[model samples]
Target: MTGNAFTAVIDDTMTAPNIGEPEEDMFRLARHLGLDIQGFHTFGDAAEFPQLQREAWDAARTALDRGLPVFAKELDLGNETSLIYAYDADGYYTHSWHGGKGHEGSDAVIPWTELGRNYCPCSSCRARASSGDRPSDGVYTGDPGYGGFVSLHWASAAEPSDARRALGAALDFALSFSRRGAYGWGGRTFYSGPAAYGKWIGLLRSNAIQSFYMGYFIDLFHESRLYAYRFLLEASEHFDGRPGDELRTAAEHYGVIAKNFQSLNKLFPWMQPHAPIDDPDRRREAVELLTGIRQLEEEGWGLLERLLTWVR
Candidate 1:
């Protein structure tokens, strides 16, 4: 855990005329990172023949041996909007390409197999799903856990019979996607949409108490490693009314999590983009805040392990 500056070096250098072999590049990168490269076997392009699969496996093993998780991050301020769009633009299940012809069932963020069945069509889902219409090319995969190809159709009034129908439809869609796993994996990728600026504000405003409670409750369960249901129960406890002991208890537990995650700011910074301090005087402050957040995430895991006993 090197804070926010996580980097992974892959073998990108090529050799043709005395440049050297691919393993040489790998060794160079490892050495550049100050890592000792003893007993390192260079992986080359030996998968061009009949046993191509074996070559790929060997290459994959080489990657794993280096212990990389492919973590990535952007270090620019103005790039936020572009990055968001670029991420969201990928794949076919997103709102960008819901109804495009020939691109059916392309979203792979969600488990297409169990999408409709386990899809949580709560406010979060609706808000994100309604961001944009399906794309012309049908390449935008929707949210995770929800396949991109499924049509958006929910009855306003709940009908007892409709429950069964919805379940059946979800299951059928999940099965269809499961059958096409290979295609979806290679051809499709998914990204979550930006939060509903206004709706999110309104929800946060209208139910600040409960919302905060739920947020904290979730953090508590996460911190303590308690049953995740504890957070849900606490959230449900405060949802109908304002906040009370239950919610407060949840918040207290979450406070511990917050103390741990305060550096990283939120459990998921991707959920909201924090404003960067632009003033020269505040620049250091901003950097410190961001750095602190990275520290929280790095150190919080250990705290989580220790706090597991407090979990529900």
Candidate 2:
């Protein structure tokens, strides 16, 4: 699916409040698409770990036997999704977020026993079809819409008021960063919204952030801005005409921001685990790029404000 379609269905606003948390996003999308997701039992300590692993294994085996991929989290790693594609008497073979350099299924092999140790307190399982309605092969045969996927084509024809509401939601989500409360794993305060840009700038100037973390922020914001650009472009379509000029302008500015983020990603290349961390020259260059990004983001926010005026 196009990013626009996916984000629209997933209801992503490309803002800090929702970014950096895939579990929430996955469940949101699943709910929007009408999938029923169930949380697994969370174990608090090593004593309870075996029960958690057993339950997860049973769920995974059930799903795999039906030719369905099992969704797992926190297996031999922390805070990422893993897809169990195959399993045997030894363990479950997964395609995880932490897989080594290779084709998807070539590496990630977590033994069942290992899962008891590395698995986090929380895990989940989901099935495609509802209870008795499930097919013999577990494949969904009915219309996908019945399974909860909203039709974006129909959404594109949304009324002006509905479109305006959506635009307003986007604006609110953007502004939330500055006002967002401490809401991250372990109560960490995230500098969100416009403040996030400033936070990165401060970190760069102080040389406080490690290379991997810096790279991760760059990658995350890059993806976020890219999504923002696409969302603005799609949103602009709803405002076609004289009133839409502001929307188009906003989209253009967001496109520039997206490009700037792309450049930053190239400079940092955070996806590489062994990327350099404490290079003064690279840090200086990043500061310059961030300054430019901050300016572009402010300009985009200004345009968004104008667009909101029209919509309001």
Candidate 3:
């Protein structure tokens, strides 16, 4: 319940706004979830780093050799994480979000030359090609040339759960999600918190809704809100009285958000947020839908903030 779903980030350009990258608070909360992760965010092409590459490769193999799974982010999964379980001279065998061939799960190997970079490191990496391109330059969405890897290892899975402490931390995160949490990278701007909704609306108003990244954003956030609702629902049981009531109400609002996002996902499946939305009428409809979502999220955020006061 680290309140990950509470924030949304996008850039001023409104390109491939991968807002899911958790910042300081989320990382701190990871400890509570029994995950001790070490990572690096690099701003150059990884192809030049043979020594570092070999080190990472050897580490993954060592982890696998010890019957442990190695974790890395933005490894051929369009700004997502991957689980490394096998490796050889060619590359690391992973179970990336983009499964199957061209990926690590069934038949994919992330070459040492490709790991550290932005989303869609190569042509074969993207699950599908978008018919739409940037109107400014007709460029399809591609990596912004930055990359990172977060090596994850199990810390203490057997540790007893601390519902109260976790709830307090999550409540703080949820409350802050609407106010702060801005980020930037590779000369690109990003907006998180409730402001992210406004960024989406702005993009919709621009009438240049990205086909691929837009769709990916919807699919990812929709799923996140779904989990937000479910987690809050379960979180209620750990509390008593008004705080519990407030959490339940907040959860209901998130449920609304999840349902609407599900509908939005259908409108923009996979990485096609601009599917039928390229049309003016449908685009206007999407604007309206996104506007409603923004309002609902803010209302839910308000409830969460209030719940924090009561719980504290």
Clashes of 2: 3
Best by lDDT: 3
lDDT score at residue 215, model 1, on the 0-100 scale: 36
Q: Write the residue-wise lDDT of candidate 3 on 246-307 in tens digits.
A: 88888898999999998887777775634425677766777788888988887887787787
Kindly state the number of residue pairs that clash in model 3: 2
Candidate 1 lDDT over 55-152, as tens digits, reads 32333334434552211001111001001111112211223222244434333332222211222223333344478532112212234223222111
lDDT, candidate 1, at 276: 24
lDDT of each: 0.27, 0.52, 0.64
Candidate 3 matches the true fold with a TM-score of 0.74
Segments in model 1 whose C-alpha atoms lie over 4 Å from true places: 1-284, 309-312
Provide TM-scores for the models.
0.21, 0.58, 0.74
Q: Candidate 2: which pairs clash?
A: 33-148, 177-192, 177-193
Please write out the lDDT profile of model 2 over residues 1-312, one tens digit for every residue: 112211210011111223233233243233323344554523234455455567667777776676654665445333344566787887867665544433333343567755523332112221212333321111112332232100000011112235565556546444443344234431234544456666667767887666766666677667867777777777778787754777677767777877887888887785645334467888898999999987876676666666667776
The residue-level lDDT of candidate 3 at 52 comes to 52
